[model samples]
Target chain A: MAFKAGVITFPGSNCDRDMAVALEAVSGEKAIRIWHGDADLPDGLDFIALPGGFSYGDYLRSGAMAANSPIMRAVVAAADRGVPVLGVCNGFQVLTESGLLPGALMRNAGQTFVCRTVPLSVENASSLFTQSFAQGETVRVPVAHHDGNYFADEATLDTLEGEGRVAFRYAEPVNGSRRDIAGILSENGRVLGMMPHPERAIAPAAHPSLGGEDGKRLFESVIGSLVSA
Target chain B: MKVRILVRLKPGVLDPQGRAVHHSLEGMGFDGVDDVRIGRMIEMDVADDTTDEALNTMCEKLLANMVIEDFAIEKLDNEKAPA
Candidate 1:
């Protein structure tokens, strides 16, 4: 059977199509499109993706409104069942807002919207989402967001670091994320939330300065891990 | 009843927006201002019979994110309505 992947779309979600395209390109299967208002997800989904975008106009707070949407209840339930879930950029904000991931993405310490390709250090490559990355290796991914600064209490930070939950870290400071942390995996390591837009980097760009196949490798990693298991 | 919720970032959390506003104030030559921290105020008219639990629930569940922010609720006597 083909790999079953579902990419969720929330209102104002601009990257939903891109995410679906990336998933399909790597999985060799049509990606399912799920809406935020739907109370239930389609059954037998092998993977779930929350694409990046300013859902709800980023009102009240980034990802605050979208987290409370009906579909999120189902997403949370699905995640609890060990489904591999990946959230990128605004999707990372949504995951933190929904309590599926720890810490909150705040306004960039520079107080400006940053859009560019930045290098990230693969902190934990053994997880479901990052199996393709080698630990301590650097991969360039495009990040575009205003509220990408990640914050967590000191104790929680210790716990996350101790548990090897930090999946990715900014190789250089692009935002004000503490410890330059760019992405993290859930306690069970099935869910990943990151500020970089991997979907945007799936294709090798014409220029080396631009992103490359790192994103495709991420999706391929998920597919490879699941198919082999 | 008229309700107001003030959501502010916790003291220790970094407030980039607030810091920017403070920088702007400094640029404007406002020497009297010691510090500035921006917050949000949300006003709503709920039923007179609304309970405190319900109000807090709304803040905790949706209005304010407990992870990085704190919220305070105030109920006005209606005559002092917000202009």
Candidate 2:
């Protein structure tokens, strides 16, 4: 059977098409486009992606409004059912706002929008998303956000690290994320949230200098692992 | 009835918008400004019988993000609707 991936498009979602194209290019199956107002996700989905964009025009906080959208109820339910869910950039904000992930992405400590390619080290390669990278390996991904600073209390930070839930960390300080955390995985490792845009790395030419197809391995790892299971 | 809602960022949370405005004020020759914090005010019209609980629910559910914002509700008499 073909791997079926779904990408959600909220009203202001700008990356839904990019996410869908990337998913199809990587998985060889057309990605199902789900609308935010809908109350249900497509059936028999292999994976779900919440793409990044200015959902609800970033009102009442970046993702606060979108988190309460009608479709999010279904997304939360799917997440609970162990469906592999990936939230990128603003999607990460939505996930945290919806209580799917821990902590919050606040304004950048430097008080400016951060838009640049950042080096990230794989912290836990055991998760479904990071299996492509050797543990401690550094990969470059572009991050663009006004509120990418990750904040959580010390205890929550300790829990995430002790439980091996941190999937990626910044090799250098791009945003003031707690302990330089860049990505994280859910307790069951079925959900991953990150501020960097991995979909931008689909092509070898995507990276101007590195020119290495590092991100292709991420999609391959997830789909291949699912197929084998 | 007229209702006014004040939404504020929770303590310990950084307010970048507020800080930016503060910087702008300093640039305008306003010195000695101790601090600046930004908040939102939302005004709405409701029935006279609207209880405080209902207004609180509206704030909790939509007007404010409890994680980062706290909201207070005040009802003003109809004649006080900003002239």
TM-score of chain B of each: 0.95, 0.91
What is the number of backbone collisions in each predicted candidate, taken in the order shown? 0, 0
Q: What are the chain A TM-scores for all the models, listed individually?
A: 0.98, 0.96
**DockQ, in order, for the candidates?**
0.89, 0.43
lDDT of 1 by residue, B1-83 (tens): 89999999999898888888889999999888877888999999999999999999999989998999999998988688786
lDDT of 2 by residue, B2-45 (tens): 88999998887777778888999999999999779889999998
Cand. 1 TM to true fold: 0.98
Identify the runs in model 1 with alpha carbons over 4 angstroms from their true place: none
Give the share of true interchain contacts found in each model.
0.88, 0.24
Off by over 4 Å in 2: A206-212
Worst 10 contiguous positions by lDDT, candidate 1 chain A: A202-211
DockQ of 2: 0.43
Clashes of 2: 0
